[model samples]
Target: MRKHVRKLKDELVKRGLDAFLAIQNTRYLAGTTAAKAVIVPTDGPPVLICSRLEFDQAKREGWIRDVRAFSRWRAPLRPGERVSFCEPLQLIADCLRELGTRAVGYDRGGKKFVRKLRAAHAASYRELPELMLELRKIKSKEEVTLLQRAAKIAMNGMRCAAESVTVGRTELEVAAEAEREMRIAGSEGTPFPTIVASGRNSWLPHASATRKHLRRGELVVIDFGATWGGYASDMTRTFALSPTKKQLTLIGLVKRAQKAAIGRVRNGAKASNVDKAARIIISRVGYAKFSPHGTGHGVGMEVHEPPGLAPDSKDILRERMVITVEPGIYVPRVGGARWEDMVLVTKKGCKSLTA
Candidate 1:
């Protein structure tokens, strides 16, 4: 927690701002209207202004420094009062003004308060969503631990998915099995909808699980992830319900490509280089056109983060950074094959944390 605050402070200094205003409403977390208001000031502890009703809950979470109540009718106004509806934002802005903050940074999508602040005070406001993105790009030790836990839950789900691969089993059945395993393994929920595509359906990247039954000698693509403690772990593994010569061959190619991509990951390597390393092998196997998506992406609080491994991405790999190395090939009428693994960038090479 202190580390996150320090990082936010450093960002404020870098951006020449005195503080940051983080405004979040419903859809931010569990769809609650008592939006969270956080004021991260440079050179001191951060303050979290939450609805009076949520103050106790936030304090219990211990994710922030100071937790203050924003009320409408008591001294500050009570709950169910119209005045309380307007107190949080005004208090936040007033606090900034008192700190002599002339410029404040924020993430995007708070136009209402931005307009109000601009109208009331002469303070210049800047939006730096990217700053928050960059700060979150590198995971801390606690974050890495949580991600490891998430990965374990995902691996459990993967094991369940692998076991569910069999002739006549519907795609939805396989997906449901994976989801049940994730929940039993302590995952809050699946990070995204589980993808259980068999045979032709495997060719679709984000194919929704359906009732189509699996067939012998067909490939089943299981793309899934689980969320634990707000961190996400993504992985994909293709299975052959009944082995066929051609299916095994394509899976081998994709596995090789994924291995090559993971082998190329290291500190200071260009994201594009890792992607190219995988694409080259897949292309050499006469499947260039079949490979659609980028190799992988950074995994963290969000399923997908910065430093995407793509041909056009300029992100440089850094030590301690965790990312996915997934390479896939889809043959239109045949089937698709992909192998994904979460890896941690290291000084010499990379380690597959989810392996």
Candidate 2:
């Protein structure tokens, strides 16, 4: 927590701001639901404003320095009475004003606070959401460990999903089996809704599990992920319930395309180049129109992060960055084939973290 505060303070200094305010709810971070606010000055320990219910926990966790409790309005005030309403925005503005702060930096959401500050005090504020995002893009050592664990859980879930595919099985039943495997493998839950598209339903991107039964000689796409330790891992692997010659050909083409994309992902390469490599392979096989989404996206604390692998994205690949390389070709009413893997960008090349 102190390290994060220092990073925020450094960002404020770079942006020429006096302080930064971070308002978050405990529901966002599991184990607590108290609303909390932190004030990070350029060169000092962070001050925490939290409810009475969270003060003790925050202190024991060593998350901040000052933990002040908010009070409610009453007819007769008690000895330790404080402000009635602890609206994060108003409290932040009041703190800044008291500290004679003229300029501040914060995440880009507090519109009411900004309005009140502009009207009451002639203060200037800068949005520093990008600064925080950039800081979070590069994973720390501990973060990488957690992500790797998530990938392993996801792989286990994928294997269960594959085994669940059979003739006369409903999409929902397969999804339930996958979810059960994920939980047994130590995943808190699925990162997103499990996609158990079988037969014709496999053609639709982001298809929800339905009552449709798996048919013989039909393709099934099981796109799923698992979340562990607040980190997420995403992977999509298509299956052949009892595939025909045509379905096998499409799956083979998609696998080749995904391999081509993964091969292009290395340190110092532009993300767009990876997308192009995959697109080239699919286009050569006459499946260019079927590929709609980007090649992949960064995955960690958030499922979708910066450095998207797409033909138009301008993000450059960097070492130690974890990302997904998924390539697909979806044919309407027929089926789609997609293969995905979690990769860690290395100095020389990329390593498949989940493999």
Question: Whose lDDT is greatest here?
Answer: 1
Q: Clash totals for all models, in order?
A: 7, 0
Q: What lDDT score goes with residue 309 in model 2? A: 94
lDDT per residue for candidate 1 within 1-355, as digits (tens), equals 5676677788789878988877731112222223377777896667677777786566666556456666665665445432234477676766677677788988764688789887766688998877877877787888788888999889989898888888888999999999999998899888788899898899898897999999987889999899877789999999987767878888999999998888889999999999999999988878999999999999987788887999999899998888999999998877899899998888999888788
Model 2 regions more than 4 Å off: 23-36, 49-62, 69-84, 98-100, 117-122
Tens digit per residue, CA lDDT, model 2, 23-121: 531222222234366667786666666665565666566545455555543345446534436444556566666667778776655687678766655
What's the lDDT for residue 328 in model 2?
84
lDDT of 1 at 4: 67
Q: Which candidate is the best by TM-score?
A: 1
Residue 209 of model 1: what lDDT? 95
